[model samples]
Target: MTTTLRDAHGEALSTTDRSALAAYDHALDLFNGFRMDPVAVLAPVLERDPGFVSGQLLMAGMLLGSFDGQLFGMAKACVDAAAASLQKANERERSLLAAFGAWSNGDALRANQLLGRHLIDHPRDLLALQLAHLGDLFLGHSFMLRDRVARSLARWNADDKGYGYVLGMHAFGLEECNEYARAESVGRRACELQPHDSWAVHAVAHVCEMQGRVDDGIRWLKSTQRHWATDCGMAVHNHWHLALMQMASGDMDAALKLYDEAVAPAPEAIALNLNDASALLWRFQLRGVDVSGRWKALAARWRLQAAWGCSAFNDVHAVMALAAAGDEDASRAGMAAIAEAARLHGAHAWAVALPAGHGLQAFLAGQYARCAELLLPLLAASSPLGGSHAQRDLLHLTAIEAASRAGDRALVRAMGDERAARRLVGARPARTEDHVAA
Candidate 1:
């Protein structure tokens, strides 16, 4: 007799192969819980049952998550496998394959649209929902991120297996949309339901970070750090959060120390790790902390990926590292790569890149007025650039510094006052550095 396994929604998987079912279930659990090593778990399943369409779909999505150009070959293979096995899949599985096909072709928006319609018919499809979340993330559709989870919540209850994960995702979306209080509450509730849910932990961390609750952020991260420290995929990012809090408290030494211990020498040369490193070091540079020699190391790592053109956000960071290191050739090449990607991809690729590339180059050249002019307009549309609000805040910080350097005292003061009001700065940090001078 053949055995079947149910997905998070209790719907039976189309596959009856026992090993495939086991691997798929294990992969789902690890993925929904944000545990590490999901791909390793799924790989054997694909090997065992080449006809497993869902396995092919998932493995392809996982490869894309790396955002590494080298992995494109494997991702394409997975997509092709799914396409070849289409006849073996159910209607929903086939629909998912179609979406993955678009995703494999670098058309993320189309894949997301397909997933969106898939959800309208099968709101309980957790796999579809997960992919949709990625789509929202890549598009910088913050409102969509929050609303998509909200739309699916009616079909889930606390008793459901992955309900806590769903709530955690919703909490993150809310935080991205600036709904701090509700985000905190929902995220905390998710953590209560599933202590090991790293996404929930991350969501609450974002709330504290945005609210400028430095003490709260530190305390919460410290208390919950162990749950995600070992097995969670977002561990380094969580540490990055802690470092940000330390920086906000004017503990530059602590921030740098954290960077060395938890961040730099990334486990992988992937864009995600590289972005955090650049963001932190750039913060140091903005504060005139003399991050000498550091940019060279970062730029060296980025040189390997400078030509990947995977994302405009990543390309901009690469430019930052190269420009700081005085590698004019690499920086210019990075810009060229971004322009080509924008041209080949669409407006989504260049909309932010063109301005961001020029702005970064202008800032490096000490043309502060030009930098500010190029960056200010894109601040409101930063979401389309594809990163968390915290990550995209790099643009705001750079703009503020440019405005300060341009002798636009009124603009600088106005921006500072607005940040202060929103951040609820009762007592400012002691250091009055160049980053805050204006």
Candidate 2:
């Protein structure tokens, strides 16, 4: 007779092997904390028990969340493997497998909707909630980011094992939706509950960055370095935030030092890490900093990912590196690829990817008027590009810089006014050096 095992939330696990269940719980803990690589942690367990559907689904959700096109095949295989165990899985597992299947099939919208429905039935499913929250993040659905967690909050309390993680997610959502004060409060509470929660630390960092608290942002991240900087998967990004604060403080030397020691240090093939490198270097480019060697090295790594056109956000960043390095042929090739991807993928590719890519191209080529023309229109509707508001601010920063270089003072002032309006009342005013420091 098979014994029923339940996860931390009391949800039934399909496997009777207590060891597999424990491994699954451990992997879930790693994933929730953004610490170790959960996929690696579960690989051996899945090899030992092929019928562990929950483990398979967890792996699939993680791979899908990576946003790396190279991992899509693995994600699909995980979905297929889980489907083979469908006869043993509960309804919740089946729903999760179906959602992963949709994501692997390139229907992220469908996958998110499926997860939303699954949550309605199983609000205590922390794994499902995490996958759904990530889907909202990748889809740039700000309201859903806040509301998805909001809808499930009543089912969770401080005593729940992953309650702090849930608050961390909600805090990020609130920040994205521009509720800075509440986001900071909730995020700090999450850190207090789980001191090593890097996501919670990141959420509060974002709040500080957005509110123009450069000194406070630096202090917050530095004070919490012990929690997030050691063996944490998100360390590079957190370092990138610190570098951004240094940039805001007009210490380009400090920012460059952070880039060399903390942010990149070496070329990375991962799209997520590459995005951070390119965004940081591109900021230097906008400031007329001489980092051509860094650009060339970063562009070389980006060239290895030439086949990854699934994410428009990634494609635009690739264009940034290639263009800044003065690799005209590669830059043109990157733009053409975006155009082809747009033609194949429709509205999002066309509206977000193509313009973003070409706008960066123009900006790098000193065609400032053309760059502003291409990117300014995207300011209001670039969420479809898929990234946090802070990440997407690259486009806004570029547009403002382009307008300034083109002698469009009205456009510059208008963009500045828009930025100032979004900032909290006590935040620093938009400085000329922030955008036009040459």
Candidate 3:
């Protein structure tokens, strides 16, 4: 008789080693819980049974998800290790490894397709669904974000252990696709089901940001603060959202305070943490606040990060920090890295990002008209940059500020009209007339 262990979704493991199975299950529990330490839990499982294909695939997925250039090597190693054990794995496990292989090899579209196919065959494969959701996020495929989760959600229910997580992911998808009301409702429902579901909390935050509901965002984040702030992997990002809400509510003091207390003081200055710091400080600069030392701190971390330049999205944020810090040498190096990366791995995404990065760098250099000229036309079609609408709005804000500084009344009005039409700038300084005066 083969001893088997099951995942949270009641899927049987391919490994007959009871310890490896238990470790694999433990790893999944950690992942679903958003502990962000699944790799640590899964490491022992892979060691105990070197042929544990499921464990290998899980490790690979987590490594790819890290969004760290250093980890790409690790992710590729996991893919290679799993190749020898492919025959021992199930069909689903084999497909999972294939997706990992593509993603590690810099073919995100193919990875997403493989994950999509795997989900179609096994909608109950929560791991595949989650990986696909992340892949869609990287590809900036907003429709796929919502639809991929929706397609699999029919197979899930409240009775499922990680149902809240699935709902949270779906809510983010819906939020990205502009279904604000429904996204908020579903996100709240997810938080109700599991208060510790940080992704769900973030989904609601995204809705609030998009809808310009500052008070609602603040209240929602505060009310659910403990769940995410204490143990969630996305604690800093959640704080970043709260800071945005604070800034929107005209509370820059509180927002900057949060940055000092929670956001920038990250244990490890990864791209995620550094991006939040750079973005928040940039927003402050736009609002005419002096973030003198903040840019220097952020730029330091980015100097290390710029060496790899694996993703164009990360490259843009790094340039923002370096440019703001007025580190001409680092900025030049970072820009060169971005150009090289785009030239080497230039997809539709990098094409948009490359000019956007140049525009941001130009803005920091006080070349306002140049910034406006570069960013204005590309504003509408900038989705391939692979960030949330809120994150991408930084580009729009930069364009507006650049236009304003250049005293380009026509450009300011054009950008302002778009914001006003969307009700994104009601009677605020971003209003056309006020911005034109600046």
- Model 3: per-residue Cα lDDT over 240-311, one tens digit each: 999988877788799899999888846565676777788888888888888979888878888766534566
Instruction: Write down the TM-score for model 2.
Output: 0.94
Candidate 1 residue-wise lDDT, 10-80, digit = tens = 65566877677678777877877768788899988888787787888778877765555567668889989
Which ranges of candidate 2 are over 4 A from the true structure?
1-3, 265-269, 424-438
Which portions of model 1 miss their true places by more than 4 Å? 1-5, 421-438
Clash pairs for candidate 1: none
lDDT of 3: 0.80
C-alpha TM-scores of all predictions: 0.93, 0.94, 0.94
Clashes of 3: 0
Each candidate: how many clashes? 0, 0, 0
Error of 3 at 11 (Å): 3.1
lDDT of 1 at 175: 92
